[model samples]
Target: MRRADEPDDRRTLERRALTEWPEQAGAQVRSVAVAGDRAEVTLTVNGHHDYWVYYRRGRVGREERVSGNGPTLGWEDPSAIGW
Candidate 1:
């Protein structure tokens, strides 16, 4: 059976991003880029840009939110995160 953590495609990656980061559940998915087993998701919520990166193992390796309160989830370095 396919587990929720193992996102293998674009749709699954998007869903996993929301499930793993519930804070961005209502956020709009601005973009989703999949390469092999990895994926990078961009979301916008409350006028701020957020990022969610799914690694080769289908797990979310990094996440970052840019909101009024600042980074709330993961690494702050933009160079360290993303696709």
Candidate 2:
């Protein structure tokens, strides 16, 4: 019985860590929006085109583009939700 708006504890912590984009990583989050069970994020990165990321589960779910071309990496943690 998890509340819809309440992210998983571990996932929340991980997402918080991602709040600051790594200096080595070229990507920067431009916007984030959540509705029901889905989240949409827009990112802009050097050497890459602007892209949109969609999340279905929280932080542990795989991230993919709703539309556009970009490399997509799956979640490393299978048990966690939302990163």
Candidate 3:
């Protein structure tokens, strides 16, 4: 370490800024809709990947679709419909 009173410099500040993280973040929803008991959703996640989620009653179906692993997901599976 430096002297007890050594002040930080611009390089240190720049490095800190580069390593800093944003205060808030979330997925950008692309689309969403509902019909009867079925719902559809699309999102671009910051960390995971894009996703299309389907829900009905309390049941839900989702899969990673882009920029990550898992199958290419789209719409709701037949089994995902209804409760």
Candidate 4:
């Protein structure tokens, strides 16, 4: 389980890498949020609209996947999420 307030740099890096998988070619990660073993990443695949991605630790760091994908999220601006 992951704590909301506390953060794990390793987990974030792992999740970020997972987000960049070949299947997501042309997509760009804009933001990342980790809560426990679950992760949510915002991206712009088409370079226009935004998308939200969901991932969870599979078998304790054995794998990661994009479980959910949809329209832009209801949060801060997309550009503010990352570079």
Candidate 5:
């Protein structure tokens, strides 16, 4: 159970290594928020905003827009979240 504000240096390094696409060159891990078996990895991919939702149960998804009824995994972009 990692806190939202925790510094995930090791994890960030690991994730950065995995992003080896040509288009993902220089992609930066902006933030990582973990809650139980869920995590939200925010990144700056090629100077563009990007994010992914990771679930412990071998499921992953990208969030282009906020939907459903609940708190965001870790994304906090107020403008993207439909209010």
Candidate 6:
């Protein structure tokens, strides 16, 4: 079984960025999780106070902020996240 905190495989990250999270270009993901086919992510940007839900891929996907809020979700190429 795979855990959410486990480092995402390069291919998984690439696929998610290209297909699932193309809209989250400039944001940085603080954490990511995958259960079965679903994915959940936590992200924050330079100007934002709170982290936001970045993306969820698969059934029952969801994104939510864990802290303060400021900036809206923005898109950046996955390469920028230093995957």
Q: Candidate 3: where is the Cα deviation over 4 Å? A: 1-25, 58-83
List TM-score per model, in order: 0.45, 0.43, 0.37, 0.46, 0.44, 0.35
Candidate 6 runs further than 4 Å off: 1-11, 14-26, 49-83
How far residue 74's Cα lies from its native spot in candidate 4, in Å, is: 12
lDDT of 2: 0.49
- The RMSD of every model to the true structure, in order and in angstroms, is 8.7, 9.0, 19.2, 9.0, 8.2, 11.6
lDDT of 3 by residue, 1-83 (tens): 12112133322322232232343535545545444444444455565566554444333332212222232343344454223
Question: Candidate 4, residue 78: CA error in Å?
Answer: 25
lDDT of 2 by residue, 23-52 (tens): 676766565555445555556756465765
Extract clashing residue pairs from model 2: 58-81, 58-82, 59-81, 59-82, 59-83, 60-81, 60-82
Model 2, position 54, has a per-residue lDDT of 56
Superior by lDDT: candidate 1 or candidate 3:
1
Worst ten in a row by lDDT for model 5: 61-70
Poorest 10 consecutive residues by lDDT, candidate 2: 71-80
Per-residue lDDT for 18 in model 5?
40
What TM-score does model 5 achieve against the real structure?
0.44
Off by over 4 Å in 2: 1-25, 58-67, 70-83
lDDT of 2 at 18: 46
Q: How close is candidate 4 to the true structure, as a TM-score?
A: 0.46
The window of 10 residues in a row where model 4 has the poorest summed lDDT is 74-83
What is the per-residue lDDT of model 4 for residues 33-73, given as tens digits with 9 covering 90 to 100?
A: 66555556666665675666555556665234443467434
Number of the candidate with higher lDDT, 2 or 4: 4
Give the better candidate number (2 or 3) by TM-score.
2
Q: Clashes in candidate 1: how many?
A: 0
Off by over 4 Å in 5: 1-17, 57-83
The lDDT per prediction is 0.47, 0.49, 0.38, 0.53, 0.45, 0.41
Find the candidate with the highest TM-score and give its number. 4
Per-residue lDDT of candidate 6, residues 21-78 (tens digit): 3454555666555544334444555436334333333344333222234333222223
The best candidate by lDDT is 4
